[model samples]
Every structure is written in structure tokens, then in C-alpha cells.
Target: MCSTKPIGILDSGFGGLTVVGEVIRQLPQENILYVGDNARCPYGSRPPEEVRKFLFEIIDFLVAQEVKMIIIACNTATAAGLEEARQRYSVPVIGVIVPGSRAAISATKSGRIGVIGTENTINSDAYRRELHRINPRLTVTNRACKPFVRLVEEDLTDTEEARRTVTAYLQPIQTERIDTLILGCTHYPLLAPVIAEVMGEGVALINSAEETAREASTVLSVSQQLHDQNPQPQYKFYTTGDTEYFRQIGGRWLHRDIEVASVALGG
Candidate 1:
């Protein structure tokens, strides 16, 4: 594999920009090709089969771009399709669940962990299973904040309504006395302040954005596929929804101007 080939990242929508932000921070030399299925934005409410199908469609698009590796940045898509994507693709495939699960397991002092994500991710039980796989005695509780994605997409993250919504969603999880909480969805990190306030200072919130980026770095290093010598790296963005909207949110998250183009997937 060529070290200079770009890494492909896919998400259900703008949420993946969270991962992109971290990747840009951690792997500055690497080129990134990101695609947001914003047209089908919240994959949380969809069926597993449908989500898997959509994931593969995006993966095909990424592969066509000649990406060196693929990162499935959506927790719901990672749950529904990570294993299958790994099996199908020749390139390295990384997902958020394992890194997030590992971080939660490593951070907890009480051995009790809480996870908040979309309904699909919570229902899939991916985080719980991954956490248990790492440490069987660890306890995991999950809450599905199905509306959090919408709050992020609509740019309502810092508003009073967001705080109220976050408080309402986190009330039960806080009662669990968990020492560590995993923001299982990529979008949830944007609401970290509200979540932290609701959960209090005792709980350590796990944002897998950085951890996932580290994992990707490790994978690239192990495969000897890192673009360490590349002084000028390219970053490209594509969306299935509105290009300008993706560009706006993505730019805000990445702290750089983004130009996004639309992608139409076949039926």
C-alpha cells in the first residue's frame, strides 16, 4: 500500500466531522477523504439491515476513491456493519465501539460504566458487549438519547433547551453511580458540556473521537501505511445531503473552511 493514499471516513451525517477533527489533530500528515450520508442523516432509527446496506454503499464509494484505510465513524453504523465491512474490504477498517469501550474500561474506578448514544447503538448492545469482552466484571448501563443527534445537526448544542434535554436523558444514568460515561455517538461529544454538567464532576465522560484517531494511527503505523513524509496533505468532503450545510458544520468542528460536494447513491 502507498503511504500517501488518503484515509476514507464515513458517517451517517455531520456527526463524523467530530472524528475528522480529532484525526486532523492527531494525524496531521495524513490526507483524509470524508463522506457524510447526510441525506440519510440519523441512521439511529433505521433497521440494522438497512443501516448495513447504506454503510456498504458508502464504503463502496470510499473504496472507489482509492483510500488506504476506512474508518466507520458512526456508532450505529459501526454496530450494524463494522464486522462485515472488515470482512469485505481489503484495507484496514476501524470503528468507534472498541476504542470507546476500551477507554471506558480504562477510565472507570467503580467498574461501572454508562453509555449514551442513538437508539440503534443502544439497542445493538455493541458498547456493552465490547466493554464486557475487555473486562467481564465491568458493569455497563446504556441510555439512548435519540434526539441528541438532531440537536447537534440543528446547531442547538449550547442552548438552554439542549441542557434541559441532556439533563432529562442523563438523569437515570447518573443514578447508576457510574465512574465513567461513554459518549457512544460521535455527535454526543458536541454536547459534552451539558452532559458533564448533568452527570457532575465525579463522572468521567469518554469521547472516543481522540481514542479512535489514536487507534487509526496505530493501525496505520502497524501496517506501515502512514503518510509521515507527506508535507502537503489533501482533505476532501462529500455529503449525501446539503453540501453547504455539511460544509458549515464541518468547518465549525474542524476549525477550518470545508468545501463539500453531493453524492447520490444508487437504489
Candidate 2:
């Protein structure tokens, strides 16, 4: 496999830009090809079968593009399709759940952890299962913050309504007295400030984006696929929704002006 091939990343929507940002910061030499299924933005509320189908559509597209590896940046999609993706694809397939679970486990001193993600992710119990598979004595509590994805998609993270929604949704988790919390959804990290405020100083906030990026770097290094020669790495963005909206939100999140091409995936 050519090490110069871009790393492929897919998300339900713009939330995956969070992971893209980390990849850019950590692996400056590698090019990136990102696809956001913004037309079907909130995969969180969708059925597992539907999410899995959508994920494969994007993955197939990425595979066709001949990416060096594929990163499933959406928690719902990861929970629904990561295993099958690994089985189906020849290139490396990485998911956000395990990295986030491992980070939460490492950060928690009290053996109590909280996870906040989309409805599908929470219901899948992916995080809890991964955490307990490693340490069965750990206490894992999770909540489905379905609305948070919308807050990020609409670029409303700093608004009063975002704060209220975050606070209300987190009230139960707050009561758990967890010393660490995993922002299980890639989108949740964009609202980290508000989450940190709600959870207070004692609780550590785990941003899976960082951990996932690190894992990608390690995988590529071990496979001897790191792109060391490219200084001016390229970034390509594609969306299945409004190109203008994706460019607007994605550029803002990534802090760089980006060009987005529109794509349609058949059912």
C-alpha cells in the first residue's frame, strides 16, 4: 500500500471534523479525505441496520478512492459497523469507541465513569462493554444526548439553549459522581467547555478524537505506512448534504477554509 494515500474518515455529519482536526495536528504529513453524510446527519436516532448500511456506503466510497486506511469517526456508526468494516476492508479500519473507552478507563481513579453520546451509541452499550471487558469492576454510566448532535450540527454550541440542554441532559450523570467522563460522540468534544462546566473540575473529560488520532498514528507507524515525505498535505472534503453548509461548519470547526464537493450514495 502506498503510504502517500490519504487517510479516509467518515462521520454522520460535521461532527467528524473534530477528529479531522486532531489528525491534522498530530499527523501533519499525511493527507486526509473526509466524508460527512450530512444529508442523514443524525445517525444517532436511526436503527442499527440503517446506520450500518449508511456506514458501508461511505466506507465503500472511501475504499474505492484507495485510501490508506479508514477511520469511523461517528460513535453510532462505529458501534453499528466497525467490526464488519474491519472484516470487509483490506485497509486498516479504526473506530472511536475503543479509543474513548480505553482513555476513560485510564483517566478514572474512582472506577466510576460517565459516557455521553447519541441514542444509538448509548443503546448499543459499546462503551460499557469495552470498558468492562478490560476491567469488570469499573462502574460505567451512559446517557443518550441525542440533541447534542443537533446543537453541534447547527453551530449552536455557545448559545444559552445549548447550556440548558447540556445541563439538563447531564443532571443524572452528574449524580453518579464519576471522576471521569467520556465524550463518546465525536460531536460532544466541540461542546467540551459546557460539559466541563456542568461536570465540574474534579471530573476529567475524555476527548476521543485525540486518542483516536494517536491510535491511527501508532497503527500507521507499526505498519510502516506513515507518510514522511509530504510537507504540503492535501485535505479533501465531501458531503452528501448542502455543500455550502458543510463547508461553512467544517471550515469553522477546522479553522481553515475548505472546499467541499457534494456526493450522492445510492441505497
Predictions in order: lDDT: 0.89, 0.91
Best by the lDDT measure: 2
- Tens digit per residue, CA lDDT, model 1, 1-267: 538889999998877888998988899999999999988877878888999999999999999999999999998889888999988999999999999998887789999999888877888899999988878999889999988988987889989999999889889888888999999989888899888888889999999887899899999998899888877778999999898878887888888897788899857
True-structure Cα RMSD, model 2: 1.8
Clashing pairs in 1: none
Model 2 misplacement above 4 A: none
User: TM-scores across all candidates?
Assistant: 0.94, 0.93
Residue 40 Cα positional deviation in candidate 2, in Å, after optimal superposition: 3.0
Whole-structure CA lDDT of model 1: 0.89
As a whole number from 0 to 100, the lDDT of residue 37 in candidate 1 is 92
